[model samples]
Target: MTTSAATTTETPSVSQTKTGIRFWRRLCRNRLVTVGLVIIALQLFTAVFAPWLTTYDPTAQDLAVKELPPGSEGHWLGTDEYGRDMWSRLVYGSRISLLVGISSVVLGLVGGVVLGLLAGYYRWLDGPIMRLVDLMFAFPGILLAMLVIAMLGTRLINVVIAISIWSVPTCARIVRGSVLSLKDREYVQALRSMGAGDGRILFKHLLPNCAAPIIVFATMRMATAILSTSALSFLGLGAQPPTPEWGAMIAAGRDYMWTAPHLTIIPGVAIMLVVFAFNVVGDGLRDALDPHMDVTYES
Candidate 1:
C-alpha cells in the first residue's frame, strides 16, 4: 500500500515534467529564439576555447604586420592597428564581456531582490526604498555608472561593480512590483498564518512566485550591461589597453578607423551580435513566461 501510494503521488510530478519539456521544445521552435540561443552558445564556446581556437596571443603585437586587411598573411579577420590578431582578440574578448555581463547581473539581482522584498513586504520600508530607487533612476544609467567608475577606479571588478550599481535600481523596481503582487496571495497568507517566519515566507513563497519576471528582467538586463560595459571601455574607464576586451579594443582601434577600418568594424560587429542575441533571448523568455499570453503547443 505504501509503495502504491508513493507511485500515485509521483505520477503528477512526472507528467508535469514531461509537459514542461514539451513546452520548452515548442518554445525553441521560434526561429529568432533559436538563432539567439545559437549565437550565444557559439560565443560562449569560442570564449571558453579561445586559446585552442587561435594560435596567436590576443595581446601579442607585431609592428611589422600591423594593419593588414582581412585574409592577409593567413590572418582570417586581419590584424589591428597594433598588429594583434583581431580574430584572436575577438575570441578572447568574449570571455570578458560575458563575465562582466553575467556577474553584474548577478550582483544586481541579489541586491535588488533583497531591497525589493523588504520594501514590498513592509509598509514602513516602502516609501524610503522607493524614494532611493527614484533617486537612482533620476540619473542617466551610463552617467551614474561612469560616476561610480570614476570613484572606484578602472579595473575589471570595478567595472562590474559600477554596472551592477547602475542595474540595481531597475532590477529593484521590477522585483518590487512582482513581490507586491505575490506577498498578499493565498499561499503567502497561509504560510504566515502557519507561523512561518518572514524569511521563509519571503524566500519560499514570495521569491519563487516572482521568479519568472525576475528571470525575464535579468535576461534583458544582461544585454544592457554588455552595451554599458563596452561604452565604458570605449571611454577609457573599463578594461585597460591590451586587455583583449572588446570595448577596449575598439577604443584602441578608433584612431585607426580611417586608416584601418577593419579594427573598429570587427569588434563593433562582435558587440552588436552578442547584444542582439541576448535581446532576442530575453524577448522570447518574456513571451514564453508571460501568464497573460495564450501559448498552445500542438500535439
Candidate 2:
C-alpha cells in the first residue's frame, strides 16, 4: 500500500516538474512569441466585437463630414473620401485580412502537405511535382498573385485563391526538406521492415514529424498572405469598394497623404505591426521547436 501510494505521489510530482520546465523553457525562448500572441488576440477581439467597439457603422456615409480630421466630433480616426468612419472601418476590416490570410494558408498547407508527401515518398512522382513547384518558385509571390487575380477576376474568393496558389510552393519545399530528413530515420526503416504500408508510414510516421517546421512556416505565411491580400486590395483586385479593407483604405487615403498623412499612416502601421508580430512569433516557434537548440545558456 505504501509503495503504491509513494509511486502515485512521485509520478504526479515528476509530471508536474516536467510541466513547469516546459512552461519556463517556452517562456524564456519565446518572449516575442508571447507578445505576438497578445497582439493577435487583440486583433481577433477587435474583429469579433467590431460592432460593439465602435459607434458608427463602417459603411455609413455622411458627406457633410467627408475627409474630417482625426478625432472629429462624430468620427475617431476621421472620415475617408466617402465620409466613412476610419476607426470603425479599420476594426471591421481586421476580419477580412485575418480570414483571407488564415484560409489561404490552410488551403496551401493541405495541398502542399499532400503533394510534398507524395513527391518525397515516390521517386517516380518527384520530377513532375517538383518541376511545377520550381515554376511557382520562379515568379515573385506578389507577381504570381497579380497574375492569378488578373486571370480570375477581382473578387474576395479570387484573392484567397491567388494567395493560396503562391503559398503552396513554399510550403511544399519546406515539407519536402523535412520529409527528406525524416524518411531515412531508423524508426522509419524499422516501420518499413515491419511491413508497414506506404500510406500508413507516410501519414502516421512521417507527417506528424513535419509539425514543428510546418507551424513555423505557417505563421510566416500568414503574415505574408495578409500583406499580399492588402496589396491586392490596394490595386483594386481584392476587396471591392466600401469593404473597409486596409489596402483599399490606404489607396483611398493616398491623395490626402500630403494633407492628412494620418490617413495612410494608420493602416500602414497596422499592417507593419501585424506582420512584425507574426514574424517574431514565427522565429520564437522555430527556436523553441529546434531539437538541436540548448535550453540552458552557458555561463
Candidate 3:
C-alpha cells in the first residue's frame, strides 16, 4: 500500500517536470532566441504594413532631390539615386525579399523531402538519386544559382526556381541522413512487421519524426535564399531598378560610396539584420529540439 502511494506521488512529479521542460523547449528559453523572435516579428510587421508604414511612394522618383541624406522633410531615411524614399523602399522591399525567401524554401523542402524519403526507402532508387545529389553538391550554391539564372534569362520566377534547385540538394542530404538513421529503429521495423504500407510507414511514421531538423534547415535556408535573391538582384537578374529591392538599392548606391554612404549602408544593414535573425532562430531551434539536451529552467 505504501509503495503504491509512493509510485502515484512520483508519477505526478515526473509529469509536472516534463510539462515544465516542454514549455521551455517550445520557446527555446534562450536569450538570443528571444531577441531573434522580436527582430523577426518586427520585420514581419514591417512587411505586412509596408503601405501604411511608409509616407511616400517607393517608386515615385524626384530627380531633383536625388541622393538627399536622411531627415529631409518627407523622406526619413533620405532619397536614393532617383529621389525615392529609402525608408519606404526598404519597408516595401522586405515584402519581396521575404516572399522569395519563404516560397523558395517551401519549394525546396517539398522537393527534397519527397526525393529523400523515396531514395532512403527504396534501395533501387538510391544510386541514381544520390549520384545526382552528389553532382549538385559539388557546385557552390551561389555559383549554381548564377549559372541557372544565366541559362533561364533572368526572370523573377526563374530566379526562385534556380535558388530552389540549389537548396534542394542540401535539404535532401539532411533528410536522407535522418531517414537512414530512422529506418533501423524498432518503431520502423515494428511498423514493417505489422504490414504497414510503405507510404504509411514513410509519411505517417517517419516523416513526422524528421520535423525538428526540417524546421531548423528551413529557417537557415531562408537566409540563404534571401542572400541569393539579393546577389541576383545586384547583378541585374532579379527585381529591376525602380522596383524597391534592397539589392538593387545597394547596387545603385555603390557608385556614390564616397559621398552618399547611407544609400548602401541602410540596405546592407537590413540584409544583415534579417540574415542574423534567421541564423539566431535556427541555432535556438537546434538546441531546443535536441531531445538529449536537458533544459533546466530556473525560477
Ranking by TM-score: 1, 2, 3
Q: Tell me how candidate 1 scores on lDDT.
A: 0.89
Superposed Cα deviation of residue 64, candidate 2 (Å): 1.3
- Give candidate 1's TM-score: 0.95
- The whole-model lDDT of each prediction reads 0.89, 0.88, 0.88
Question: What is the clash tally of candidate 3?
Answer: 0
Per-residue alpha-carbon lDDT of candidate 3 for residues 155-220, written as tens digits (9 for 90 to 100)? 778888988999898888888889999989998898889999999999998999989899999998
lDDT tens digits, residues 86-167, model 1? 8999999999999999999999999999999999999899999999999999999999999998898999899999999888
The global Cα lDDT (0 to 1) of model 2 is 0.88
Error of 2 at 121 (Å): 1.4
Best by TM-score: 1
C-alpha positional error of residue 275 in candidate 2 after TM-score superposition, expressed in Å: 0.6
Candidate 1, residue 165: lDDT: 89
Best first by lDDT, ranked? 1, 3, 2
Worst 10 residues of 1 by lDDT: 290-299
Give the winner by lDDT.
1
